[model samples]
Target chain A: MTEARDHVVPRRLIEKPAGGARLRNLGQYLFLAPALVFMLLTMVYPVLSNLRMSVYDVNVATFLSNSAPFVGLDNYVKVVSDPAFQNAFRLSVYFTIGSLVFQFTIGFALALLFNRSFPGNGLLRALMLLGWMLPTVVSASIFRWMFDGGNGIINFLFESLGLLDAPRHWLIEPNTALIGTIVANIWVGIPFNMILLLPGLQSIPDSLYEAASIDGATPWQSFRRVTLPLMRPVALSVLLLGFIYTFKVFDIVYVMTRGGPVNATTVLPIYVYQLAFNFFRFGDGAAAAVLLLLPLSIVAVGYLWLSQHEESSS
Target chain B: MNASRSNRRPGWGWTVLSTIIVIGYLFPVYWMAATSLKTNAAVYASPPQIVPWPPIFKAYVDAVINNPLALRSILNSAIVGTGTMLLTLVLASPAAYALARLNLRGATLFMLLLLITQLLPAIIIATPLFVLFSRIELVNSYPALILADTTFTLPFAVIVLRPFFLTVPTELEAAAKIDGCNQFSAFWRVILPLVQPGLITVAVFAFLMGWGEFLFAITLTTNETIQPATAALNKFIGQYGTQWNNLMALSTTVALPIIIVFASLQRYIVGGLTAGSVKQ
Candidate 1:
């Protein structure tokens, strides 16, 4: 099932060497300066600026003038009070959780299936990555068309299969619009999950599985007892990374519904985009963005700690 | 383990089942391509013409030849993609090399920063960047979009390339230094050529990121003249909500380059991905 050489490039490249004191050259700081400066201007400054904008009263008129007065917590208060904010907050939860559950399960299933020896395993796996490789806009557009109410293929299939008496417009109804976006996201995400999980699956020793079988364990029993426990670390990383990716989804929802049919699909990112760009409520948007970033920041910190832990322990 | 695994051949049943699964999963891709080829009427038909019986170029014609914005958006994407790729390499390679070899005191901390930056939501950065760009009158310009795109790509490029740099034995650089090459020249003359494959991989990844970028392009550049294919496709979907054929055609056009690149560079790209994620 696996390639003769699973890695096409340097095996030595990825293996982290133990921390050792090496030649220290301050001139190397010159090498680092350009990227450091660029990141400071781009990443560090923008994040801090976002924080600043959230606290200040930044409207369109004041945004450029650099004269917005400090209004600590007011923007956050208003953003929280807005009915739309609450709605988007709830939807964001549903969207993120909904996407994570389905994509992870389907992806894991595919990974396990592909782990066993079979013909064309490599080709099929590569083909599966098509969904992940394509740009989000492309995937979202295809879904938008396929989910069209009147003449969409999904409606045609549902009616033929006797699942529906008539075509249900997937994206039009507020109730189902979030589901539509989640479905598309699952397609986009499944490939990624499968790819990551496969390497982890490969890393588990077959001798452990053989021992389980020798002990009269059934395949299901072996999976639960041995595979599941072994897969925990990889699964943790996959889910955390997937959570962050799905939580900040912008292109799929934006292209599919644009938080449409009465704000039905407005996730946090969409909400932030609308508040700032559409409504010209920069301060409130910044506040809302900070709210969105809050959980992600926690998750990011957890992921960092987890990776560092994995590194040191291993 | 290899011999035993290879000897225990799975039945043809497994092959058939997996093939079915692949086809089912890839149905959306097929549908997109098929719809793009169908006539406008065929697109709206109830059964949705599982096969575009007699393919037509009408949608492609309409999408590209008729709608001038399609070509313009594609051109904008190229410029941005190229610009971002070049900038990312120039900035990221040296930094990545430094981290890999220089053993700077703060290298570990800087790497942590890069990883977190890669994970930061684009909207978070876009909000401040939009305000900042408008203030500086950099909004609605190619430089603005390219610069914004780098916020995502620079960290990514650096992360991906550092491993490649580490693979290059430091003795190579030491030998170059012995030959009277300064540190910079030694790195430039000796180490970089060895990591050309990694450089190519990062360039492709960065270009694709730039080409497909949406939020920054849309938020920063309200000018129709400067919008990339992604924003243009979105605009098309909104304006021509009923034009499924044309929409699919445009979507296919936007996605074609990505497909080509992926096809050609599958090995290196896949290797780079696993190295970044799994090895971490």
Candidate 2:
């Protein structure tokens, strides 16, 4: 990928340019050069610089103390030891797992549901996407209000129906708070998953299904044997994409809980912000931020490796 | 006939299931709008008012006129989002064209690089970028906000634009070149115009990212004047916790534009994103 991007693909890009196409050359470069520079400056530079910053001492106190030491890898060690950090780390895993499973299951189910022709299908698809397109703050805000201990929709409905004897602490209770945010995240993420899987469903030939049914394969058996394997690439991409987006989710969690109720819902991004801006410990925050990046970088690298493997075998 | 009848059963099951699924999915958004128009008293009234009667626009009014932050944040968001779309299009379209059409030897590599850049979650770079921006005195600047935030949306533009650009054959460009146009002019005149849908998708992605940016906006900009609507919305959940009525009203307002745009352009977005996603 880097080779193709960096210095070895211009000849290929021509796509059979006729002999001496001057306008073609200029127009193509005209389109490509500026974007390359832009990515280098904004996207690539900060990432490289941050990787460097991860190694240095960057706290305000350290700036105050000329003697403040640069301890390589120590901040990573410290972040690993802190329980709050540990909890945040654990939460990221749970959040990623819970969201991926729910989003995929529900999203795939919806995709299959929408796959067949039905009445009001168009309206349903549009309405289903409402949660996905509505900004996180907007959706989370509604749910946050709904989850309010006193007047929240959950409590109000349950209490009035006489389901619960008392108002439940939906957002404050340790167990419920994480679940609340996850539910909100799932609601927001499903549309994306469904949309991705829909295309995969479309790509499958209906003839395959007809043949399967003719052979006495139930719909369940056909799905397991045929659709599941065929949609693997689409399914994997959605899972990874969901993880990439959800792992760094800020607006929803922050808007809903601010990682509160004894820090029950704090994820890594919140930790990064709190440390840098709130605690005024830039160095510590830098360290925490690096810690967050480490796990994500590993995941990114692993996915990239798998993709390369797939490309090579194909 | 039995086989046909049995096949038909699953279709009916799917219809029933989809209706139930959609209702289950839309419940929260439904609740949000429903609760927003209710009076504070009615909002909290026991047994809940799922169907708010004598609905009030009081929350909308509060969010728009009463809450000082809402207006400010929306303005700030507009400026940042517009800036991102301009920057990405002005810069990325050409590069995407080049990657798709030029003689650059590493074109596939460029495409791959863009894809790889997207693999990591933004949290990985948010803090370090935060500090770096602050050091350059660009933390509070709109330009920095737009440029830094484009990382979230621009790669998809590059990837999405590629296939579209790739579909435009070299024959048109060759003809344009023969007619004395420069390569850049040919792209603008011949190839670019053909890829307008890709450009629209790119613009939408850029706008959404800039519109929805929260972490960086909240972290980078301290002043209310510069904060986006999302940053300001976060302010509603302060030390005392949520101010639900005002928050709901603002949420309704935040969602209204997307709902409007989505109502018109959902097919494009779904088609565009699906194409981009399934390409791999």
Candidate 3:
């Protein structure tokens, strides 16, 4: 990837003939034109428009007319001051960190498990992707059924094992609702993390582990020394990617609990959605949405840098 | 397969443990399928029917026949999915080819733009898009939904397809050019055909996204008549709160197309996923 990126410019300069080079450049731009135009209109324009909307007093009337009184960070202030913002912010952190810690650990465990060859290894790995491949709505809804209070299978299992005194409604109780969504998100995420980590694990040379074992290292010690250290870059990439995906989650939480049992699962994306669509507070919503971008941008930059570093280092 | 490191055949113990783990992990998917096949009595049975002993198609029948809403939403989803797939392919292929084969100025900038576009939350894009579409009277329309779906798909398609194009040696295009083919024909005729798998992978994923997309479908379209399957399924859950059998049936139906595609093309799709994200 780095080789392709680094040498593209000079190769192009040499490849193009002097005559009609400008016209060829223009023609090449034509190939990119449609996608560029569509992206500009849809993605780039929306982001800029969202930024403009964030600072303006974009009420329903002003939003429709495309003319808003410039409130100049009032929207941001209003959103930040709201108690819901704080709760949502806290929940977002809890949800993201909680989801990441479990998803990575469990996923890494699965990756390690599958990293060892066994009969049906490839098939099992592929099958594990079922959860990840299903639409988030479907996953959330299935979880919703399983977490039901009265007849939910989760409750049934809990009661059968005597884990709970009673069958608690997981998604209904405020205390457990966020956990419920987090569990569902974890399930949705595990397969992805496992898949990402598998390649990292595979990239490790087997001779290192063999040498470690020959040096009287136990299997556990060899894993801790050889595998974990070697897997660091890929693990970081997986966690960063997982954080980005988990942080902006909306559909799963919305579908599972509608971000409630009294604001339990109301993460930042849900908060933004509620502000923008349900309450028609577009400006405030845009402000909150823009705020969500800050951490993501930092992480995205980190991710890009890390990926490039991995490429060059490898 | 690195497990046979010492030249020892993998023990069946590993297979047994792995099988048990896979089964436990996939139990939810099994439950979804099982619940979909169960009769209402079986659905409500205490301790729940792990397997539909006497499986019935009543829920499937009910979801499809008794509920016009389910069928209509599916049809709407199909339209959106197909439209998004076509639009993404039409736009993405050329763009990917350009990025791969041509050294246009600001190529790095464009690549950066594509990456940043993907990182923006759907909510962020949805907020502005809703307002903009409303101004242009495009809300509550298929085009609106399809276009919104494309925001994610287009970037993904280009990213995935560009790798495929890169692997196709520039010599192929050069050879075609030497044979009197122009740049457009060389790309249209030679390069496009070579990346068929990538195109299919991108198309399948784009379609899946369109079919399963919830946020834009819900936020951009208020009319029940125009909403896609994911949004309609959410509404179904709300309207028919504990009708687990029907909900699972609807969910299963909505999920079947994607599952089928994934199963058949697991290799390419998996490869495409790693290529799109990790780029290593």
Candidate 4:
């Protein structure tokens, strides 16, 4: 009897003309067609072209020419072996990891602070976002001036606070240029982390905390057992997104140091920019870009997985 | 009752701490504005002037009059920003609506594609885009920057708007369909009005992306006349001797619109970020 009912339901559902259903499906696809076409032309084509151009021996002369020769794996070998690429790869790793650690820790503290109801909490949190909202160039320029060796406010403040014996060249010095850029990046990223995590903090029901309190749990215990596990998904998303964002940062380093002081701050993006634009070596630049994509793609994939899992679990 | 009272009255300490933190965070922005009004000597003083005593408007005047490119760059930024916002909305809204509402095949795949697109860094595509745009004779045009900026904003717009569309109940569209309205009109009359805030959020974000865009703006537009403010300000880095005061003036002008937008749309911006990331 159940099988017969299922058959009847199918028959009734299929009573509409197949042509009409097909036409409706086509119309639905038409809704997606414009965006898909645009992405294809702009995003997909450029990525594929980058890959193609990486294998060719293209420079200023051959870049505009149709006769650029194909050199299989040559550009990749050259970029990978170049000392500048090695230094940049090392610096990029340090910069991204350093920025992420400081940004996350400070942002988490701020998030915890702002999680509670206070008189001026809302206003303070809004003001905190100014760092994140300001244009990258503006922030970079501000930091450049603030970190200037001669007349920088930072040195002035440090001297006033008795933390320094003399003014230091933050951007021009080889040892401190990368660190200066990293400090600026950390400031820029903290608000992003806090804003994302604040919602996660809010989502935890008060009942959980109440229950914890009734059980005579300490505040630290409650945070460890209740908040940490609940906030894990949000935390993961923030870290992964932050990793990708910070890893590909160009403008901050560009404006502040220009990946300079003898390539102290030459992260991968700046490295690729210098190769492609400044030096006019399109093939090597494209090769380095592909290299840059490898690590970011891993993080991106992880983020996509975590976000999908969060959606499904919720 | 006593504990709750104490908690509620834990006032001055928290207020002072929070105020200090806020001031620390906003100090750089304050310095940017203050430095712009300082005289050259005061700006470079041994103890950097905390506030420009008897604040001067010389740098502002110099930024406006001496720097012709500053005004031109701002105009170009507006043009590019507006263009990108409009293009992104037109393309993303329909797609986002379909993905949210229609139970279509391959919807998951489309979403996955969009997610992956966000991972592709702008520099990876800069080389090829330069080649292609120059080939098509669009190297220095507004459309070139607008189109490139859309590449960054389109996925973001879709991601932000999809959740909003999901919130709009299907029953409203179904009821409209039951009446005389066709599918298009049902969407137009029933759904569009409800998602106005989402549209505005996406528009503001897209505009900001275009305005603040640096990599593509620098890569594509070699002409100062067509360059945006971000790229133009980059030129003043080592130029005009030290010119720190003038640079700060230009930076302040560039940062003003962003500050205004954030102030007015704080709610939507925060909502969009949270909804796009955490909720998803």
RMSD of each: 6.3, 4.9, 4.2, 5.0
Give the share of true interchain contacts found in each model: 0.62, 0.52, 0.62, 0.58
Report per-candidate DockQ: 0.47, 0.48, 0.53, 0.47
Over B182-258, each residue of candidate 1 has an lDDT whose tens digit, in order, gives 66677777889999999998998899899999899899999999899998998999899888889999999999998
TM-score of chain B of each: 0.94, 0.90, 0.95, 0.94
Task: Give the lDDT of residue A110 in candidate 3.
Answer: 92
Q: State which candidate has the highest TM-score.
A: 3
Docking class of 1: acceptable
Candidate 4 lDDT score at position A188: 95
TM-score, each model?
0.94, 0.90, 0.95, 0.94
| lDDT, residue B121, model 2 | 51
Estimate, for each residue in B1-280, the C-alpha lDDT of model 3 and write its tens digit.
2344523776577788888988998888889889999888888899787879778999999876678878888899999999999999999999999998787898888888888888888999998999999989999999999999999999899999998999998888777665556677778888899999999889888988898899999999999888889998999999988989889999999999889988998887787777787772
Greater-TM-score candidate between 2 and 3: 3
Give the lowest summed-lDDT range of ten residues in model 2 chain B: B1-10
Q: Would you list the clashing residue pairs of candidate 3?
A: none
Error of 4 at B217 (Å): 0.8
Model 4: docking quality category: acceptable
Query: Clashes per prediction?
Result: 0, 20, 0, 0
Report the C-alpha lDDT of model 2 over B1-280, residue by residue, as the tens digit: 2223434555566567777878877888777778778898887677677788988888888767876767878888889989988887887788777776667766777776687677645654666567667667787778868877787667877777778888998878777665655555667777788999888888876887788777778777877778888887778666325556666777777777677777777776766777676674
Which residue runs of candidate 3 sit more than 4 Å off their true CA positions?
A1-14, A17-19, A311-314, B1-10
Worst 10 residues of 4 chain B by lDDT: B1-10
